[model samples]
Structure formats: structure tokens, C-alpha cells
Target: MKTQNQFQLFKERRFLPYFFVQFFGALNDNIFKNALLTLIAFGAFNQETRELLTNLGALLFILPFFLFSALAGQLADKYKKAHIIRYIKFVEILIMGCATIAFWHHQLALLFVILFFMGSHSAFFAPVKYSILPQYLERDELVGGNGLVEMGTFVAILLGTILGILLIRIHTSTLFISIAIMLTAVLGFMTSLWIPNQKTISNPDLKINWEPFSQTWYVLKRAASQRTIFLTILGISWFWFFGSVIITQLYNYNQDILHGNEAVMILMISILSIGIGLGSLSCEKLSRHKVEIGLVPFGSIGLTLITIDLSFAHGLYPEQVINVSTFLSHWEGWHILIDLFFFGIFGGLYSVPLYVLLQSRTEEKERSQMIAANSVLNALFMVVASLFSIALLTLGLSIPQLFLVIGFCNLAVTMYLYKLLPEFLMRFIAWLLINCIYRVKITGIENIPEEGPAIITCNHVSLVDPIVVMASCHRPIRFVMDHQIFKIPLLKFVFQTAGCIPVASEKENPEIKERAFALVKEALDRGELIGLFPEGSLTSNGNIQQFRKGLERILNNNPVPVVPMAVQGLWGSFFSRRYGKAMLHWPRQFLFSKIGLQITKPIPPEEFNLEELKNITQNLRGDWE
Candidate 1:
């Protein structure tokens, strides 16, 4: 039986310890960094030195990624990750000690050094943090796991940033702040102790390469070989770029443009953070905990459109520059806030799947290296975004204009990527159609094998039948379809990319029929679920046709369990026979159609009598005839 409860995911020891460790790590990092930034802005450095110090601080933080990430990736692959994390936390304590001295002496140089050390700690920790996810999770749990991690990280950042600023303003002793950081590090270290020893998957006998840049590049190239993984990495990097640009610009927008106080800054960040948290949680609900990455493009489109809306809402230099409170008092501010929230929501939708894809698809031995490569990409993109922001400001563009540019750029990048990989766009279209237009309720999904090969037998009722099943199935499926349908102008690209098998009737094209069966057999042999409509063709009438014999041949040869399934409530729709001449029909309601899927228990080959299975499927289908 499958469960959807969030707490149920933590019952396994493999995830909980790591979860706490990561959560606290994020919390502490944000707390200290925000505190340091506040000190610099307020009094730690004079205005003349503040800009240089702040930029240097940013450089020092990202520098470790460029300098130590390859070595970090190597270490994560060389030893047990639990031990490494423990040692890293201990180093964090020592770094905090340095922070205490810096605060006491009011030494800017010492503070910068501590910040660099903190970044170095994060650099070393990055590879292990992400790479260990796959080892602890089942493939099905990957999405949920990644969602939780993302949610936790963002929540921690939000809270820590808020508290860090708030706490420093209380006029508390500097020693107290130092103590808080130390205790947080200790707690994180203790949590690390609870993580079970995960052995190194890659025991590279070769000595570590010290040339970090070249070594990191080589690792990235290796990760780029897998098409899906490579695309996912790009997707993740794009997310960081998008997010960093928005959050960084938001500070200036709030302070200078909106004339808002620190409270307003907190509010904007809080809304974005909460939206991401909700969106991350929504992935489990929307996908039913399966890693359905097709949602990525949908998220990207939403994000881009909302950002543009936000830009327009601000308008090009309004006559009155409203303060934060006054802006909120007006309808326009509320509109912008709503837009920002949804932006975060869609942002959440975009990121969760990429994390799952990386975790589930990468080779275990090099998982850490791959994650390090991902971190490197994230750092690189962030740097580029920073540079872009600086350049845009230098070009005399206002903050709002920069926002507009980034948002439009987001649309361009997403479109180009989707054009290159039509599967993403197709899946997005299918997923949106199913979720928004049809209320897809499913039963007996468990009958579909959790792992390994199985044959899915269904009634073919429409041209889009395969897509309906694809959208609902928990796992990926290769569908056998009519060759002519596969050749439809724009759709041929999608069908081919999805690797759907195209077949002609034996009487029509014997060679195509033979090739189709061969592909089906090969897919099943590789433990992939293959879907075939036993009717051999869509019914011209709104009823299930007589069962075909191909399903029998498949089961006899492979001897795997057979899952019988059906789709109800689609017959009267435009895609069905009820529409005039089928393919000529247009979409019925823009956003309200009824659809349902039901599955019967898997019948072993020995128990699979074709007539019996057909009758059982008919009964389960409940008179779709």
C-alpha cells in the first residue's frame, strides 16, 4: 500500500538525521551571514569601506566553491560522509570562535576571514549534502525527499535571516551572539552523529587533483553525459540564477524604490519563502509523490508571466513614489504581493522535480561528484546573475527594468530548452490538461508493478489516450500507438521524443507490425512497463471493442504480470467518438472536463485468460460502453 503522509517519510533513519543536520546548517549559515551584513551596514565599516567589504565578502563566500569544490567532491567520494560532516561541524565551531574574536576587537579583516572560512565549510559540505539523498531514498521517494530538503532549506534561511537581523538589534552582548552560533553548530554536529555510516561509492585509487577548476570541469562533463540528468542540472542552475536575481534586487527595490523599512524587506522574503514551502509540499499532493518533472515548464511559464505582471503593476516611474506601508494601503501593492507569492509557488513547482531527477538518475558512485558539479553550476550562475545585475544598474536601468529583463530572459531560456526537448513541453501540456481540465481520480494504481516489467492493457478510445495514461501512471511508460497518429505534423516530434512505439496493422504493414512487437518485447525485457490497447485501434463507436490477441503474445513471451486498466468519462469529450469525426473536434471546456482511471489487480501469466481478463476489466470499468 502507498501512503501520502509527510511524517511517514521520516520513519526511516536514513533521512531524519541528515534532515536535521541540513536544517540547522542552513539556519546557522543564514543567521551568521545576515548578522555580519547588518554589522557592516550599520557601523562595523565606514561607508567608504562598506562597498568594498561587502563585495569582497560575496567574493570570499563564492570563492571557496571555485577553489575547493573539486576536492570536496573527491573527499565525499573517498570516505564515509557522516564522519566528514561531523568534522566539518567541528570546524564550524572553530570558525565561530574566530567570529567571537572579530566581534570583540571590532576587526573588519578578522570578520572577513571568518566569512571566508564559513564559505569554505559550506563548499566542502555541499557535495555530501546532496549526494547522500539518493542513498537514503527509494526511487519513488526521491521527489518527496527533495521537496522536504528544499522546503527545509528555504524555511531555515527565512527564519534565520529574520532572527539574525532582529537579534542583533536587541543590544544583546556580543558574547551572547557568539554563544548562539556555537550552540547551533554543536546541535548540528550532534545531529550529524545520528547519520548512519554511508560508505564511499567511488574509491578512486588515483591521487586527488589539486587543479580545482579543470577537475571540476571534467566532473561536470561526466555528469552531462546523461541527457535527462544534464538537463535537470541546467534547470537547477537556472533556478539559482532566477532566485538570486529576484532576492538580491528585492532588497534595493524595497529600500530605495519603495522607500520601505527593514520590516518590508522581511515581509517580501517571508512571502516568497512561504510560497516556496507551500509549492514544495504541493508537489507531493499534485504528483501523488511521484517525480513528475513535466511540471517544470509549467512552473517556468507561470514564474515568467507573473514577474512581467509585477513589473507592469509597478508601472514605468509613477508620479508618486509610495512608501511600503502606503503602497500596501493601495490596491496595487496587494496585487504585487499576490504576484510575488505565486512566483514563489511556481518557483517551488519548478525546483522540486529537478532535485528528484538528479537524485534518482545519477550513478551512485559519482553522485557526490555530480552534486558538486551542480553546486559549481549554481555558484557560476549566481556569479553571472550578480554581474548581470551590476551591469544592468550601470547601464542606467532601474531596478524594476532589471526585473523585467530577467523575467523575459527566463521566458526565452525556457522556450529554447523546451524546443530542444519537446518532452518537457508535451508533458507540461498533458499534465496541465489533466489537472486543470479533468479531475483525474484513480483507483488500483498499486496493481501497476512498483518496479520491473509489466504489461498495461487498456481500451483505446482517443488519439490522446496514451497521454492520459502517461500523465496518470506513477512511472514512465512506453505506449504502442498507430503509426499515422504518431506522424501527425507537430506531434510526431513529441511522440518520437517520448519513444512511443508506432505500429501498423499486420494486414496494412507487416514490417511495421513486426518492428512494433519487437520494440515492445525489448522494453518489457528491460523491466519497463509497456502499454497496449487491446482493441488494436480506437473505436469509431463509443464502446470498448473486442480484445485483440497481441496482449496474449506479450504475456506468453514475457510471462510477467498483466495490469488491466480503463479510462472513464473521456468518451463524450472532443477527443472521443462523440465529437464529430474525432480529430476535427476542439477542446470542450477550457478548464473543466471529467476524467477517471481505474486499474485491476495484476494477474500472473498462468492466471491470465484473455476472455476472463476482458470481462473483469469491463466490470471494473463500470459500463463505459
Candidate 2:
């Protein structure tokens, strides 16, 4: 099914009300937290007490995610998510009401108590916010849905923070801030009332553990049971850690490096947030509304590069405080802003897909627990990140130096993840090639099985046939490519990481050919998908070459179902020989060139034959040649 733009989701009732509820929830949280921080910072407390209170306030908010997330996950799993959200929002109204009294009477202790409750509110809401999406959206809508949620979250945060800062500067700061928080909470509760109810995925009769420590352990153990899910959780945590480090240091980065005042700080934050919003929105377009892990590496790489650039981009301006307008007047200011913008853009790219992956891959019954686990780890990582930043600064590392270290560390961490899950790297390459070079449209993708062994045979029309097929298919596919093409320097890494089988003609390397067949059989026997081009090589003429016997050999040995797919519009692509030699002549269009892929029903191994497979693929190609 064709995907609607992420924005279009707002027009539908299923998503719009939920979006407003979440938006207002985040908005209120930031408004209250930032106002409290600002009050403590500029209020009448002594330097020691003020600093202690400020830090404690931040810690107070994060503490609940650690202590209450297990229970929160349990409730979300056990109850209808939308209903839970309404109850949570009602609690938020009560909490904000208490906050109003606290702020009105200037009761610091009471305000601190309210802060903890607010954190608790967020902790409970976290699991429900993410896990409910799968119940609300289609599998294909996960990416776009997540992107919109993330974008909305950050944008709301930005606006909330701005409002907090502006409102807190008023003469009756406390009263104004209190009114704002209470109003937002009431609005959030009203929005929650409009959210449609969704069925809980967890067992209704499932036992609930009331002990926080034991329940947290139980949830953590469950998360660790699934290796892929656990790694994805870790990936999400690392991104939080990485992003937090940069954000925490930005205040210092602005003061010490950019030598900017408050307005300049806001300007930098606006650029960063806008960049993230844009990058998050772009993920759906890039992934074709699919959960594409390829963007994870792509995003991580860009984040690292941009961070390194930011590290260098600083220290160029004069060490004198300037307002946003004055800072913008300088060329050096634009440089710094550009780096900040891209840093956020890449950060968004790195994060949204993994969130979608976590949502889509986990079983419905346990999904909330998985999200709670993610929140717990995310909090841990952020705490560690705070300590790391302090340690780095204590070591006399400059802010720019800190960024440089983070950049290199990101490179190391992503490489490790790529090593851990080569599928992520495979999808990254395929996503990059398809998005950058060609516009690929996939049809009949449902023909591929959602699980179990299947051999997908496509006519080899271009060098990039495997990539296009990989990007389109929901499941990861091990491709069988010519040994020489597999050995090509840059392309080799992609193929090897994707676990592609390298084959040679029997006359050239019979041993390697035999091993390739063995790998294909092994993959099939394991119920994994394997892709092959029956033509053995890319077509020299824009016509289907005679089918090879390799498919016959594989089906005979493993007898897995065979899926025949065809690439139609690639005959004249730059990767194809319809021009001169592929890639040698550069006379074709650069971007948005149309390409098409069509898949036929899976042929049972007993019914599969070389001639029949070839005919179906050719017919699917039709007039595109």
C-alpha cells in the first residue's frame, strides 16, 4: 500500500488526538521543569544551596524513570493504552494543581515533591506512548509514525522551553508559570479523552509484580532475552547518551566557545531543534515508510562528521558576549549554526528508525515492557554521559575537544554495532544507493514470505540489482553474486557484511561454486531468505539472459519456496549497460530517476523450474525494457 505523508496522519482521528495529548504532555513537562530550574537559578537561595537544588531538581526528574518504569510498563501492558493515558493525564492535572499551590505559596519542598510526581507521570507515560503505536498503525506506517512522534516531541520541547524562559521573567513569575503548567495539564487530559482505545497486547490474567526492584529486574531480563531487541535498545540508549552529552555541554559551548548570551543560546537551540525535526520527517521519505536500519549507520556517520566539524568550527569567534542578531551578523556564527543544524539532523536520522525497529519487532504483549526497559537504560546512559562529560572537563579538555572525543567514540561505537549486526550495515548501503542514485518503486512485495526459508530469483539487469531487492524486501536476504563483483573494493564490504555468497563459474573455481551452493542450502535450511540472479551476470543487452542452473541446484537440495521478482526500469540506469559500460559514462539523470521492481507469487519448490521462473520474471518486466 502507498504510504501517506507523516503529516497526513494528523488528518485522521486515530493519530491526531494522540499526537496532541503527547505534545501537550511533553510541553507541560518541559515548561514546569525549566521554570523550576530557572527559578532556582535566579531565586534568593545561596550559591551552594542554589547549585545543589538545581542539580537535585534534574536528578529528581530522572530518578523516577529508574524506579517506576517497571510498574509503568506493567500497567501499559495490562490495560488499554489510551485509557491508561487518560488516567495518567488526569493525574498530571492533579499534580499540576499541587504544583500551582506550591508555586503560589513559594513552598520549595512541595515544589520538589511535585517535580518527582511529574517525573513519575512521564515515566508511566513513556511506555504507553511508544508501545501503543503498533496497535494504532500498520507495519509500514511505523517509521513515519515514529518520525512524527519524535518530531512532535522535540518541537514541543523547544516551544515549552521557550515559553518557560519567557514566562519566568515576568514580575509574577511563579503565578504565571503555575497557571501555564496547570492549563497545559488540563488541556492534555482533555486531549487524552479524545484518544481512541486500543486493546492491550499483554495477558489479562498475567501476574503483576508490585516490587520495583524485582519488577525492574524481570523486565530487564525479558529485554535481554531477545538479542536483536536488546541491541536495538542499547542503540537507542547510546543515541540518548551521545545526544545528551552534546546538549548538556551546549550551554557551556555557547558561553565559552561562541561567547554568546541568552538570545544566542536560544538561536542555537532553535537551529538544532529545527534540524532534528526536518531529519525526523525526512526518514519516512528516505525509507519509503519502512523501518530501515540502514539509516542508523548513515545517521551515525553524519553525526560523527558534523560533530568533528563543530569541534573545529568553534574558537573562531571573538571571546565576547553577543546577542543572537550580532552573532548572526558574523560569518563564523553561520558556520557554527550550520554544524549545529546538521548535528541535530543526523541525530534524528540515527534515532527514529531504531525506535520504529523496537516497536515493530517486539511481540505486542511484551512491547511496553521493552519500552520501559529502553527508558531505564536510556536514563542510565544519560547519567553515565553526565559523569563522562564532567570527567572530560575535569581532565581540562575544552568543549571542542570533548566534541572531538565524542565524534571518534561515535565512529567506534557504530562500527561495533555494524559488526554486531551486519544486517544494519547491509540495509544502510542499500538505502544509501537507492535514495541517492535512483527512485525505486516496489510492487508485489507481499509475495515474499514474512518468515522461513525462501529463494528469491531476479533477472540480473544491473550491478545494483541485489541492493534494490534488499531495500524493497521486508526480510533480510543473503545474495548470491559473482565472485569478481563481490571482490570489488568498496562494494565488497557491503556484500560481505550482508552475508552475500560469492560464486564463480565451475570452469574457473569449482570449489568456490560448490561452497556457494552449500551456503545457500545452509541459509535456506535455517529458514533464512537468500536472493539470486538466475542470469549469473548483468545483462549486456537490455534483455533477460538465459536462466542459469544454479537455481535448479539450490531448489533440489533445500526445496524452499522460490519467489521470482524482476527489475524493470534499471535497463537504462547508470548501473546498467544500456548506455556504454555501466558507471563509465555519466550522461544520465542524477536524482529521482524512476526504477520499478515487481514480484510474483512464491513458486513451491516442486513446481519451480528454470524456464517457468524466467518466463514469469520476463512477463513481470513487461514493456519496461
In every candidate, how many clashes are there? Answer: 0, 1
lDDT of 1 by residue, 387-479 (tens): 777777767887788889999999999888887667787787668767887788888776788889988888777777788888888677888
lDDT of 2: 0.85
lDDT of 2 by residue, 1-625 (tens): 3246777788877888999999999999988876776677556775445534655676678778989999999888888888889999999999998988887887888888988999999999999999988888878788888888889988988888777766877878877898899899999999898998764446466678999999999989999999999999999999988887897677557766777765776677788888998899999988877788988998999998998888887646776677888888877789989998998899889999999999988988888989999999987887777668767776778889999999899899988987888788888778877777778778888788878999999988887888889888767899999998898786788788788999999999999999998998888889999999989988999889999887887877888899998987887777788888877777565687888899989999888778988899889999896
- After superposition, candidate 1 runs with Cα above 4 Å error: 1-3, 10-13, 40-56, 170-173, 198-211, 313-324, 488-494, 552-560, 583-590, 605-608
Alpha-carbon runs more than 4 Å astray in model 2: 1-3, 40-56, 107-113, 252-261, 314-321, 441-453, 482-489, 502-522, 525-527, 538-542, 549-561, 569-595, 601-609, 622-625
Q: Alpha carbon lDDT of residue 478, candidate 2?
A: 95
Instruction: Give the worst 10-residue stretch by lDDT in candidate 1.
Output: 314-323
Clashing pairs in 1: none
lDDT of 1 at 581: 70
TM-scores of the candidates are: 0.90, 0.89
